[model samples]
Target: NAMEGRVEIFMRNEWGTICDTLWDSKDGNVVCRSLGYEGFTGVPRYNSFYGKGSGRIWLQNSSCNVDETSIQNCIKSGIWVHQCNHSNEAGVKCVPIRLVNGSSIDEGRVEVYQYNQWSTICGQNCSDSEAQVLCHSLGFGRAMNINATAFFGEGNGDILIQNVNCKGTESSLLDCGKDDVTVQNCSHHYDVGVKCSSVRLVNDTHEWEGLVEMYDGGAWKGLCAQNWNTAEARVACRSLGFDGSTAVTQPFKMNQRIKAKFPTYFDCRGHERNLFECSHHRIPVKTGWYSNDECTQAEVRCIPVRLSGGYSNKEGRVEVFMNNVWGTICDAGWDSVDTRIVCNTLFGYSYGGTKVSAGHFAQGVGDILLANVSCTGSESNVLECKHSLMTDHCTHSKDVAVKCYQNIRLNDGKLEVYVKNEWGTVCTYGWDDADAKVACRSLGLPRYYDLKDNKKLP
Candidate 1:
């Protein structure tokens, strides 16, 4: 069973015999690879494990030289076989698949919204850096939990394919995808998972305003390991525009690996231009007894933060301070529904209809945290808003700020259709009738209008 195979393969609704011409171990490798196997364990020979099938075409003559993707491409056309119906199913069996050097989903790894499905990391070109980030996201410390097989456990259900192409500069494993320019296969293993911990790093600020020291630099320092608390973490988080610190890491657990720039100690609030613009203070060793190694190795806790642009309503304007500049909210596209949510968030909207309104309600252009906010009538704040595009020549001065006009009732059911620059009400008046006929038939609703004319008025 090492050089000859007597199996009838189906192709082009015909059955044929595969000659031994151009058959060798290299061709065998192509077949195995196409079938999701690592490589050819042995060549097809006499008494080899052959596949039997009931289909359109059977017994294919194959010639393989390159990394063929499917078995159909490996073989040539063969004789016509009897058509196969569902009553008879094609069956094929081979030696048990063994796990090799690869990555697989762990026993209890659950993706965010991907449900309970598990996948294997494609083996085309997986690197140790990707392994490190993936391990950390899964709650493992660093790349200490790298595995070459489905060691954690075999995944159930459909085998998902995750092609990870790391350039070594990606901050996280998920950022990588199957790039079209260069294609590779990670089908070496059927299932893959990762084991991770929360061993992450924490840095000082976002933008590097001046001569701020980096992680290993001895000049700047962090809080001593002496009984760090959530309050300290909260303060540090707020300083960096974060909602609060999610977790605090103790000594011996911090990531001090200086390999990659990020996986560095601070994920900034916004995509900052530099690293020192954030607000957390750094400990400068002016005259204190400190060494470079001492500063880098000292037990400093990390404050993982949930971040956002901070905004609050004052008087009648939504105000936010960023980059040390305080600015007001613009209401260029603000409306009652948008303001209703804002009122509920800022002040309880128990007064109902009279609590929030929007009109001449524009705030002087402040630092534009955001602009051109399109509300589907379900959002809370402009900071949390999303727009179609950045808009043309958008300066912070052209940014609209919002402040809810007092006394407004929330309107839900009625659709707010845009017709002009100012939101004019489409009165229920003349909402019926010939008006619709003029609009519809004017635009070619002849069939609909003809049907109405063919019948009498009900």
Candidate 2:
């Protein structure tokens, strides 16, 4: 009564109806808007969708332009009509369809409103074209798959429509060509469902590594890690616009408590545009797999990290981009071994560099990512280093820094120095080849052959 069908008006203190001669969604939209509903699409009903009214027919052959505000302003003669009867009563749905029982907003079973009740669409003869329209109408890109056998789960009430033939270009499912409403001949077990490519990574600050959630059948459901592997993770990373997943970890802890549903196990060949394209077991049957538990949560980590705020390209304050934002690392227990991994990964320097602290270069602006970082000096990246989870106890004043010696060079045979990110000649006041040899060795160059007086060199 509030959201679906039956256009009625009050006249002479009695409820009346309108004629269905020219009723449509455009006309229904005005009524729905008048009732204070947004994003409303009106479905025209011919045979008194609400019920047969007992009073005079107040409007007949009502025509409304899209911009018109009210049905009262849609009469042909701008006057109430008494020429129509209750038999020709018109009805309209303010909000006709919705996705229900799914994991996310863009996914769910297709439900349509008719006869003042919600009904499911039969999976019989349902196709991608029909699903495309449904997904697009729900503000999703397109339909990833049309599940015919109630993949999301069965629905209650009547099977409203069957054999829906959509051209894939329609705005709504009602716009698609379909059989008459009276020809309902399908069962609830054959209820139609849709899966959209609206995927998200939750819990972790990094975009790549987190609990994987997919929008399906009307809600956000977690993906199970039963058969999840690096191949599947790679596909997920590629889907999210990354090169590929570096690691596929299972049972990753979620920051917030969640009642995860739909334990889907993916079987991927390492290449698929979306997760749904990968063959999957909708409900995994692994031992100890719980449908409503977080233990089955699967996570993936994509490789994305950088060194910033250093004097040279080889070294600086370490920052990682995750959850669509950049953040720095804390120096709580930072050391040379931890800084070595970052220097090796970015600068290709075999020897480990020195660890600087207290924002040696300058303070970073955002989050202090890692605290108590500890590496074995053999890791390829700083992410491989063991570190405490970021906490508010650390601040930018304790931001970690590194000074890599990879950029040191001699300029014009002079004992030039490169520190604090600049090039200048060493004072040479204390002058000896032993000091020169040590400097040359630090620069990874051959030992100095001779030490000449500064006047002789000049």
Candidate 3:
């Protein structure tokens, strides 16, 4: 019953509809404001945009000044003064939409408001031209891509708009051509999505370090540094394809005249993938934190690290990615301390693990970048340890490998292994009861099975 369409009014214990002969924004504003909206800035429609209503045509030739509180108080001819039909039913748009559940503000599934509820748009027959118009309306430069299969994520609630067609230059999506109000034949799986290039880090030469700039409403704005912390920096760094944030710097002085367009305080746990994923507090202009001397632009630095050539994210042939090249580390003096640093860098936590040599996991083919490596167990990254830049003594056969304990799991009482991010049963070949006992002890569980029973466990 909340779907878009014809305007209807209830009076004298009977339902009646309004005629479109004299309907406009003034009358529509009165209807929307009476329904608890702040003001109606949306367009008024004729020819039953929401579908024709079946009832008495009560109001006709109605006119309302913009200051009217309700449609009943508006200047109108006597009730049912002229002949009319359901084809002349009136409709109004009271609310608009914005994107959500995306990795950035510029990407996500499309959602619109109707009947006091948020709804998704079906991607069926949605085109790139329409997406371009939508991006422009949201203060974006243009749409880079349009995903029609709910690529970001499936949405909930009603499917509002469908069969949208645009010429790629419209100011708003409401001005686009669409199918008449009818039951949609699509589901949430076919929800529409758009990716826009609207955010960037500026004022720095490095890709990982810069002042944040974002587009909002209809203008580009900068953020304030009242409560900016490392956790918030981590999200920004991760959004730029870094492992995490190492530091948050406030070097630029605050400009009180420059309005802060984003949340003032961000509460992140250092694991969110995007800035919007964190809880935030909007700072009013009158707040004490908005003072000219207190405001400053925030900048961040991120650690550039990644794991490669291992079956699982936890256990990998140690590789350092820098300057856009993937290179391996020599196994010379590789030990638990060095492996611990790698695990900490990858998983954001330490897991004391075993180190393997002679290409135990697999040989890596690249520059034997580092050799004679030594770590103090307190190093945050492998590169922080003492190591040689290049070595000829070690080959791909001596490439370093790690089997972190965090990558193993027990499923249904069976010792399962995870490699390359996939879970599978561990091979029992050459495995003895001593190995099983150590595994059980690591998990803080009693050893209940012998070596002969290991094969049956899986």
Candidate 4:
């Protein structure tokens, strides 16, 4: 919260404000940096932008260099106090998001700060990836839960954002929908309340495996291996932003003398998003020592899922993260419907996706996690698609790839459909205005379109 406000300093045991007389954005950058934030668009607010400050005018005539480490180091006149006329005071807008009215900073109704005011993102139509972006912006690892029905109560002012679609890799909420900004006059009933958690693997050289140290009650605590199992591991890895078909959770002996413990007496069904929501009592303050016999820590490793060997990020070999660790999937049943789910889940939402040839983009070095993935054109994620228990029945020669028709690349085409790894031009024999409208809607194009019946193309 200190990131955005009128500039103030502790002088002679009292809080005081800086004069806007010589303050500029360079000074705002120094202020932001001094508060331990990367230099973002630090816009300096002049003449009581955040309302007049009642504190004494402490410093005046400051000409700060953008490269300066702090405002104190900038070229400024002495902090020899000034008259308080309430005319001009320096302020800034930096912190983009916050979690309000929750038991912890990681859980609450989401609030956003933009253009010098705090507001809420209204809409229950949010995805898990979008929620994860929100959590990541707040320095939390990922979203564990989203309370869509105004769970944390109402927020102040008008709804700030609506219909936002984050690609899940952004650093802040302010960076969303740069190409397509979303706005609406949504009601407070659909306020987004979210819960987030952070996880870190400890004492291991591998990137994905270590003794699990879940942040809880304001500190990182070892997960008691009392009932730690595959279910809990699934939640932990998802909290770490990894979505694979499976994860490995086992008891790891990291006998510590005085580390706090998060005991899991077996509640997670492995289908939940995060570990904390699996049900448990509040983790008390730092307490007794934990030995391997009394409290063994949990060690978890998740096979990360990602797209690799792509050109321009739109199409790629759908590689499983564990290069050679996991086996390949049988591409015998992979379909465009399944690819649509993959694109919608991994990439941003798209009108439709085509299942390109196995070797279309680039052959995957890692095995594809999908095993005969089949969807009925209604699944939200590929994980929910039907899959066989069999893997390693395929090869890199059959390593599947995809091309999501993201947005309206073309308003009018021959309307070719991808089936059985081959593109075929659709017959326009019975095509009509209704069919044309459906095509336009799928591509998210304008409603106005011309339909040419019985028209032939070369």
Candidate 5:
């Protein structure tokens, strides 16, 4: 409760809450810092998020720069001020993540400040992806290594983060689907240890992977793909913030715009911490490469999946990640079963997806990675779905797209229910879950329509 509660300030021989007027993150930081906390991660709760408070309202329009010494150092109106009530009292929450009992501050057993107590994370589902989030959140470059075997020893407090699954791009560990804490199955022996790196991923379009460039002599330079291998890639990807990464190394085609290259050849034993840690020396830079030159330099796909060219993140062209790059799926055998897998892979669950017409999300470029795709509606990933022997001349025009978590009867917009040869919406005052279920049955589909609330029109 000390970490988060109604913020009350003592003034003029009485304690009184501050009014939630013009309260911002800077103001929240001043409050948290005043209470003996690093307030960089301060979050303000505007509408009494920690519940209402009693007593006279003190300050209003509290303005503070984040660097202020305390709430008292901030500018405020006269005490016992007016114009606000208890329901609008100011509140704040601060996040402070640190590592304990480590060789250094950047490496050790992970502990997070929460609920007025320091908590340990269970190593149950902890991995490199989750480590990336922890490192990034702590102002480090990326997670270089994670030891689920209690590498830096363990902690004694309650285990708050029992399970974590991250895409390796989240700014905070809390954002990356830290599973519900109602169930706690952890002990000190199962605690996690993490090591962060100063290495950064730059010049990348996607989240997980990008061009292999090294900063030497003060400028970023691309790595020459001459002697690169999977061993080098494994180290490089992890340095760039991938968790336990098994990288897909490829000779990335580069244009003439790339002026400089990493002159040294990296020869990794496949277990080094980073590319620099690997043995390396100067290598001859090959010339005679023009535009569209393959392997002019190297790039790594740190294993990623993304939806592209769609209105929403979930509703998009089904571009599967395969062979170190993102490619499309052919609509040849794409169906409801296949859609379910893709939707579930992108999202946790699908409410019976329906595949749209070909090129509905726009014709995709690059290889048609999958074709004759089929699934039994049970697989967790679309790529795992049974399919033909790869794309047999599948064209871009046949690129597949899906609309997930929608009523199976609707496609893109409202007023769309596939009635008997017509299109219209159900208009009724008492229209609820019952009516929608009945409508689905009439259309010969299952119940639980994956419905969203529709506004009642005038």
Candidate 6:
């Protein structure tokens, strides 16, 4: 074979070697022409054959794009068997068929290709949470529906898993498994089918969490905490082109918070490109406050982030309901308490000390809009700014964006945090005692102040 994978060849007549240089799709065409094979798949790599012969005539090379006759011309001195056995033969593998359909197969469900075959797995231990993960892995949004007991009719393939430890929202199927084990305690009666969901952009809210999809790549940004009004918030939301936002909330301490994540504010013009491509600014802080009631109108921006877009690498959409518009929040106020709201809203879990920010630290955009924007500890919307504007040469044009955590999954089974637009895997190795005390205190949990894990220094 001439091109695609790496290989060496020697001609039977000259015992000389030649290396394939012209490797391309054209080479693949030649392969099909000489082989009389229909439908060109693509060039695969890896030595297809290992040549073994006497002195130097170890192998023969030909352009993959050549016809059988052209290949014959390359070796006029002698004719080698078309399928001769050798140790140094060029090798290539046909690519596996990629299933374009976005759907999930459950514990027992099975489907047959053109080939009439059948196989099934036991759904005895499959849970909806686990099913959510499996479905998402299949290029679908979270699983919206699940059917079991041969729902799709039994088909074939090894019952690959059993007693799966699925967490429903896992990023991948392998994450739930124990090392190399597969097909755990499964039975023939378990068959499952999943309904894949589509991705949709969402804004942040007190009761709900929004996902971050894209990043602007700079300092962690902050939102305008000045005497903002709902009108400005709406403009910002519209500027970022978010469908709309829920009640704006004042950012509190997120237990799993990381410092300097996300932009201050987002500016979407509804007609602009996605959020990542839209223009954004920062919210300046002064005198422990954003802007005073001196300004009436301010501009904001947004980015279109996909929540369940089948791109695990992509962050979820995480926006804060700042002003009336949905703006990105900086990780400025992120602390254990703030992360508590995120975990509770997204994972339906009881608050675990906001685990370490197990996600990327989105560069911050600006400082918090207000140093002490008064909140009843639960006020939504950062506009209740009573503090005076802290900046000098700032205007609505310099409004900062906000960042949020759409969803985060942590090491403690359900511990999670948001940083930038991405979710991070928390580090358990270096977590120490002082951090624990800070975390516990942030959660309003009585400081254990005694346990080894909760030890305090000085």
Point to the candidate with the largest TM-score. 3
Candidate 4 per-residue C-alpha lDDT over 1-458 given as tens digits, one digit per residue, 9 for 90 to 100: 56677788777998877766556545776787777665343545555667777767877667766478877676456775544245567776565566778754457888776556667777656777778777665545556667776789988776767776778887566676732233454688888898776777676355555788765323466776666777888777766556533344444445543335643233677766666456433211222333233455677755444455677566676654332243445577876566667676655444466666676655655435667778776754555567765466677788767766644323245565556755556677897778777765554343644644555322
* lDDT scores of the candidates, listed in order: 0.36, 0.66, 0.66, 0.62, 0.65, 0.36
Q: What value does the lDDT take at residue 412 in candidate 4? A: 46
Better of 1 and 3 by lDDT: 3
Q: Comparing candidate 3 with candidate 4, which one achieves the higher TM-score?
A: 3
lDDT tens digits, residue span 1-458, model 6: 33233333435445432222122223334444444433322332212223333334232334433343233334422444332233323333222111122222112242211122222335665667866665454333444445566665654465654555775556555577532234555544565554433222234542222322222121112333333344434333332323333323122333232223222344444332223223333332221222332321222323222122112422232333333233333333344444344334333333442323313323323332332233332422233323333344433232322123244433454345657865566566877667655555444454545445656444
Worst 10 residues of 1 by lDDT: 208-217
What TM-score, computed on C-alpha atoms, does each candidate reach?
0.23, 0.32, 0.40, 0.33, 0.30, 0.23
Q: In model 6, how large is the Cα lDDT of residue 169?
A: 56
Residue-wise lDDT of candidate 5 within 130-245, one digit each (tens)?
98778766645556678787878878868877778889877578788876463366688988889875444444455455567664323456765666677887777655544323
Q: Tally clashes: model 1.
A: 58
lDDT of 1 by residue, 11-71 (tens): 5556543433233333444555655544322233321224433334332334555566555
For every candidate structure, what is the RMSD over all alpha carbons to the true structure, in angstroms?
26.1, 21.1, 16.9, 22.3, 26.4, 24.7
Question: Where does model 6 exceed 4 Å of error?
Answer: 1-119, 156-160, 167-171, 178-189, 201-458
Q: How far off is residue 75 in model 2, in Å?
A: 38
lDDT of 3 by residue, 259-302 (tens): 55443456788787666456653333333564443446665655
lDDT of 2 at 271: 64
TM match of model 6 to true structure: 0.23
Q: What lDDT is reached at residue 447 by model 5?
A: 46
The global Cα lDDT (0 to 1) of model 3 is 0.66
Quick one: how many clashes does candidate 3 have? 7
